[model samples]
Target: MLGSVTLLLERLGARTRHLAGSFVYAVGFGIEVARQLVLFLFGKRPAFRVLTLQILFTGVEALAIVAVLSLSLGAVIIIQGLSLLPQFGQAELTYTVLVVVITRELGPILTAFIVAARSGTAVATELGTMVVNREIEAYIATGVNPIAYLVVPRVIGVTVSVILLNVYFNVFGLAGAFFASRPTAGVALWEYVAQLGAVLQVRDLLGSALKSAVFGVIIALVSCHHGLLVEQASTEIPQQAIRAVSRCFVLLIVVNAGLTLVYYL
Candidate 1:
């Protein structure tokens, strides 16, 4: 019995130490990325091509799917709320619910999930492949800072893409809700718009924007950090990509919940 207890304690200690080391490493990685981002912003020579390509891939290419999903989600909410809320004589509350769910909560979280599944995995896979090919080594040999040349652009691109996508999501979502309400609720477009405007506060928009920015940072940092963890084996590329996506999802949810809790508090 004593031996088993000692063994369990040893295992727990090892895991705790590993988690602590990982946390420290991630923090350092984030600091370095931030420093490089500042330099990239102010430096004479910026990698415009890379940054532009990243945005094109992460944001522009993702619009169709984001639009479809947001529209469907909003329509469903409007239909359900219109059907049920009027029974309780709380029909006017539908707009408030729409603003709260589509704008404040689901908008940012859903966009982050989409970006993570798409761009997060791509970033990790691309970086891991480059690492396996020793391109990172070549960059170092050429006196090019890999973090500045490669990682910084991606971080910025993904962060910008996420924020833009979140806005896009909100717009389409609210628009879909308005249209869906027209047939069922028989409300004019202007009336629906007015109702939404009445319930939607400036703070709701600010909270949403804040959530998007924070989620973007989290996704980029986690993806890049895992991507760089790849070693010589090509097989590790997919493994790292999977890790990046999974970690991004978990972090996004945790951070979103924390932010929502803060907003309520």
Candidate 2:
């Protein structure tokens, strides 16, 4: 019994140490990426072509799905709220609910989830493949700063993509709700617009934008960190990709919840 307990404690300690080391390494990687981003902004010219392609792939390619999901969610919210809130004589509160749900909460989080699932996994798998194929080594041999040329572009692209997608989400979601209400609730466009304008505060917009930006940074950093973790075999690529997605999802949720709490407090 004593030996078993000792063995368990040893394993736990090893796991704790590994996690601590990984956290420290990730922080270092993020700092390097930030430094490279500043240098690129200052005309160090990391890789404009890579950054453009990354934005194209992660942002532009993702519009259709984001539009569809946001539209559906908004329509459902409007329909349900119109049907239910009227019974309690609180129908006017629907606009507040819409802004709260779509703008301040679900908009940022759902957008983050979509980006993490789509772009995060892709970034990890692509980088892992490069590592496995020794392309990263080739870049190093050629005196190319792989972090600057390869990673920084992706970080900026993913972050910008997530923020833009959240904006798209808010637009489509509110517009869908308005149109959906026309047939069911018979709410005129002007009245709906006025009600939303009244209830939607500047803080709400700032909060949503802040959440999107933070979630974007989290997704990009976690994805890149896991991607570069791939060491040897091709088999490790998918595993690292899976790790990236899982970590991004978890971090997004935790960070979103933390931000929401702070917003309320």
Candidate 3:
């Protein structure tokens, strides 16, 4: 029993060290990507082909689900908020509540969930397959940066997609509230909108956008890191994918709390 316990502890220590090394490598990958992006500042530079693939994965594929969810969420919020407002005789507060809920909290959280379901799994599985086939080893031999190729494009794509989708979510969700609202209250479209503008500041939008970007980076980095760790066995790919998702969810919640504290506290 003593020998077995010692061996288990040794394994745990090795795994912790491996994770620490992976994080350092991922950070280095992020810095190098920033340097490469600087070269694209020149208008004449050719566009990145990887970005096109990422757009397909992040934007085009995610649009339908985002649209459906945004519309439904907006209608539900208006109905619920309006229903409760009469308790306090302040129905106009619906606009403020809707804007705050959808813009700041729901938008980033929902988009992060969507990204994890769609792009996150794909990233892990792809990189895992590369490892299984020894393609990653070939890249290492050729001096290719898998992190730059796999992670950077995903980070850029998911961040852009989440922000764009959040904008659309606010637009469509706010609009849907009018149609789904009850007949008696019959709040004017402009009235709710005016109330929203009165309450919500530009800072709210920027803050939400930043949250989405953080989600993108965390998911991309975590997914790619696990994928790169895939072992020789085929079973390891799915295991890594699951680990990546679990890590992303935990990190997202922790990050959201930290950001909220920074802003509100």
Cα RMSDs, all models: 1.9, 1.4, 2.8
Mind giving the per-residue lDDT tens digits that candidate 2 earns over 1-265?
Answer: 9999999999999999999998899889989999988988887675989989988998889888999999999999999998899899998999889999999999999999999999999999999999999999999999999999999888888888988999999999999999899998788999999999999999998999999999988988888888999998989999999999998999889999899999999
What does candidate 3's lDDT look like per residue over 1-265, in tens digits?
9999999999999999998987788787668756655544443333357767777778778888888898889899988888898689987788788878888888888888888878788888888999999987887788866555555666677677767777777777776776677354676768666777898889989988888888877877778777877979889999999988888889889998898788787
Error of 2 at 183 (Å): 0.7
Give the TM-scores of the predictions, in the order they appear. Answer: 0.94, 0.95, 0.86
Window of ten residues with lowest summed lDDT in model 3: 38-47
| Candidate 1 residue lDDT tens string, 122-166 | 999999999999999999999998889889989889989999999
Off by over 4 Å in 1: 1-17
What ranges in model 2 sit over 4 Å off? Answer: 1-6
- Predictions in order: lDDT: 0.92, 0.92, 0.78
Question: Which scores higher on TM-score, 1 or 2?
Answer: 2
Clashing pairs in 1: none
